[model samples]
Target: MLKHPKNAVMVLARCFSDLDRRLLLLILIPPLSLIVFFSLSSLSPVRSFILGRTILHPQQAVMLNSTDSQQSDVVFAPSSWKDELDRSRIAVCLVGGARRFELTGPSIVEKILLEYPNSDLFLNSPMDSNAFKFSLLNSAPRLAAVRIFRPKPMPESELQLRVLTAHNSPNGIQGLLQYFNLVEGCLTLIQQYQKQNNFTYDWIVRTRVDGYWNAPLDPKFFVPGKYLVPPGTNYGGLNDRLGIGDLNTSTVALSRLSLLPQLDAAGFHQLNSEASFKAQLTTRKVTPVLKRLPFCIVTDRKYDFPPVRFGVPVAAISSPGPLSGVKCRPCKPVCQGPCVGDVMEGLNKGWGWTDWANGTLELCNAHGDFDEGWEKMFDKVAGKKLSSERKRVWKLTVEKCIANFNKMRNRTGIWDTPPVDEICKTGITSGPK
Candidate 1:
């Protein structure tokens, strides 16, 4: 009459099995549980990497993390420039040879002062027998500071040897090293000046002392986020010829040698000046914008105008310029007619060479012997008002320099650990800007 023992046992086991199944679900889905718990525990590391990358490269990462519960408050945006007429606090650092400074210095100074009177001037030229006298630059709109140092040549070192050897001793490689040394020294000088004065620069304008300015340095070319270099002379790449940038940009661009390793790895071994420049810009992801500047390197070397032979002069200062600054002069071209036409035809791509066929500029040559008429012509072109202004500025700069020179006595800001040899001295006396 009592139910079979087996049936009673089976009924009890079924009820237990149902209870166990409910308890298992309450404990959590194993896979999902592991995910939530670990994510919460390791929250800090994941958040940090995401935030760091965001700060470094914000442009690429924006919409990807929208749904994440963690919020990124930082926003990265590109800079915008309205090209206002207001003066820019620019610093022109001239630290190279002085041979052509006299011919070109006045024009450059006058143009900048007239166009952007708010700019400041700084010259870091090391002492050389022929360095441009500061008297020329004295007329700058606002005198910031000038320190003329006797550049200590690159110390003989392994790096110098390696750099000299690296690119098969390519043409202009030595010149490259010389330029690198000059720039690096001046950058050091800039840092020192900033520390001493407790001031920083918004932009640094670098050019040879002898670069003649034929017209206004149009500020419209200053793009917000990219470095600008003159066009035309883009020899195999970016012309390392002249450069302008803010402090943030310059810190990376100034040291040419520091970039050699990367350049070599990128297979950029035999680049000419222009090509080297292009590689440097593109490789480092430094965006470069080409713009026409109303200036050209005052050169003294002479070559055939419509060069047919390798040594023939294909490109010249004259060519009806306003050549969109690729590398032609806007001045009355010395080589008119056939030479201009030939060079124009020979030009390659958006690179080297320019066309003056439209005729808005004139002829001038840095390499040609100076004519007395040329000086008078410049004086006339500059007008009486600018001449007087330049003269006055020159006087003030000379006086300031003399005052500074006397304050520092014989040191004259030229630091020589053991002191400069008397025989090697260029004897730059301060009385000018």
Candidate 2:
């Protein structure tokens, strides 16, 4: 139907006299189709953008269908996946105070650190009486850095004041700044490790010290080009509790303090931590993947029972949870089934919301202190292994705590904390007679 062969080739190439015209013609021509197919097949498949710092195309995202509850349960494990992870370099950056580390630390060691024994652990936490509890990290497979610095007032810049809001933060903007400092400080440690080793890490896991994991972090959550976060508990932005990403994307995620100027330039104002987290990722063109992860934030803070539209829902530790980093505590459940449905339906999905479908969630009436005998409740829910860890911390003496800290310090690549004697004696004292 073409006037000439050149014209036909032009139509396929969208131009004439091009170097690729012959190649295009070969691909388009029916006679060469089989030959072209075989040739291309042998040329190796085009690699995905995931393994590098390139922006991922939307079509490449592997996300659970938001409406399909069962999609979250489907995990495809290639035989070589775990072996591949073992070969890859990973950094696990833990931040925040070890307030309830006695309860949460063991779960973290078992579920995350041991799950991928190759990962190097880095902790950036403020030194306090509870910090001695971090001696529990003696169980970690590999120690990269431990910085238990004493807290000080972080200087708040004009840009930071403009970009961040004190709306929901307990200690206002200063608290947010302190938190940002902790996260960014951990990033500095990771970068320094890579610089000293002359090699970059393949992945970085940034998590809170207070988080408790009910199950192992599955390999499926590691999508190469995208930053992974637990779905829900996003108060006007992304969930900031736990994050997983490749080095490039994680660098942006962990630059919580350094990126405020960029956020200010972008006209983002009065953003909460979660909202700011989402903004930073969007500003850098880093795609965020939301998956239902099996972890929860163990907190002593109480929330109103039968939460309203914008109120927080505190979950009971006994719930069948991939709680997705929602606030939870060891307590007797006060709501389930239809009751949960009623409460969750009334809450705003954009704020203080988490997946409660299919009996996966149970609510706790957290208006009061932790239920009497919560230690026993925690032990029962945490099983034999983690329960032993709890008991160990409960009965820990200054002498034993110092011994554990010294053991951990010996294994650590960088020890930035105070002396083990000071750390242990500052916290542990003789128990009441």
Candidate 3:
């Protein structure tokens, strides 16, 4: 109880010394040292550290702090082009007959339409027995316009005869004219919709109904200035199977028929579909950018099996690919690896050659028709829901088909085609008139 003042002072001094030693130990530890160092640094230096700069030695910290404080302020960068496109108006212009639409349509719905649910769909197809398949679009998210018309023979002008060739086109020059009309016709419909609504679409995706998409359309394909098309199957020109571009470039690319006079004037002769497409872009001064895309044109056309040089190599539907809109069908792959390399070597580089390197392509012996139970094969590859759609279409009754068509017609902003009864009945049993 009778403690001396000197003894109390000595106890206090010893306590202060112990606290200092503990504080030094804490600062010397790696984790706490970092925190202490940052705490002591100026705000600008701390901000630089957080913005991916390495912390300097304590000796250099003061120098960095002084330099960073003198520099301009940092600013955040904007979002990517994909984010811009997600908000922008996009028109998915699907052209061609619904020949294999049952196999292909669901993929379009799942990959493109659902992937970009805000994009409007414009369906321009010539009515055929397979036209009933177009009814599947009732499941699509944004159906904008539908034009299923009777195939009328387009009058082949002298210029068309000169500028276009019947070489590989099954229907000859007339067929080319009809296809051109269909594509350009979709552009016209898009323009009409824009005029009516007082707003223009920022992008247009021109693709075929027969395309079996194995993957979603990558947003990187949506480049602003240049038109994007597939790299191979140039056929002495560019791959015309699919195209993606802005409004201005698409107008030039899609005006397939209207630009015939321009092609004729440019002295382009005997040009096939792809060549004509290339001519159009060249004439219009639109630079085309080629990227390998994930879909292929599902075809019934027979090509030489074990394709020779310059012969078409049909891809197996199951091949892992950005197949770039090449001809494909479901079948057991006949060729792979070295076999693919040898077959691809024979094919003309400017014509049918696709990048088969690193096992990117698998070949189908397409000389025969699609293998039996191809639906099962497709289902296995496309997943449960898409396969179910295929079965539904195959087993579709006339009544249900008509009902689906009605729903699609109701959703469509522009409906131009035969009556629903006729479209539905044509594909199903041909009953008494």
Best by lDDT: 2
User: Model 2: clashing residue pairs?
Assistant: none
**Which ranges in model 3 have alpha carbons more than 4 Å from their true place?**
1-80, 430-433
For each candidate in the order shown, give its overall lDDT on alpha carbons: 0.54, 0.86, 0.84
Sort all candidates by TM-score, best to worst.
Answer: 2, 3, 1
lDDT order, best first, reads 2, 3, 1
Misplaced by over 4 Å in model 1 are: 1-89, 141-145, 151-172, 309-320, 323-334, 337-339, 347-351, 360-368, 385-433
Q: Which 10 consecutive residues of model 3 have the lowest summed lDDT?
A: 60-69
Winner on TM-score between 1 and 3 is: 3
Model 1, range 1-433, lDDT digits (tens) per residue? 3389988888889989988988887776887788976675456446456555333122222222222233555433323121232434566666667654555677777766556676655565656644434445534655555555655445544444443443422334566676676776566666776787788867777666656666776554444446766665554466566677767666556756677677777766555555655676778777765656666665555544444423223223443344444333223446555545555556454445543555543334434454445445545655675456545533443345445334433422333221223212333343322
Q: Compared with the true structure, what per-residue lDDT tens digits does model 3 show for residues 242-357?
A: 99998999999999988889888888998999999999999999988777889999998898888887678899999988788888998889899999988888777767566788
Better of 2 and 3 by lDDT: 2
User: What are the models' TM-scores?
Assistant: 0.62, 0.84, 0.81
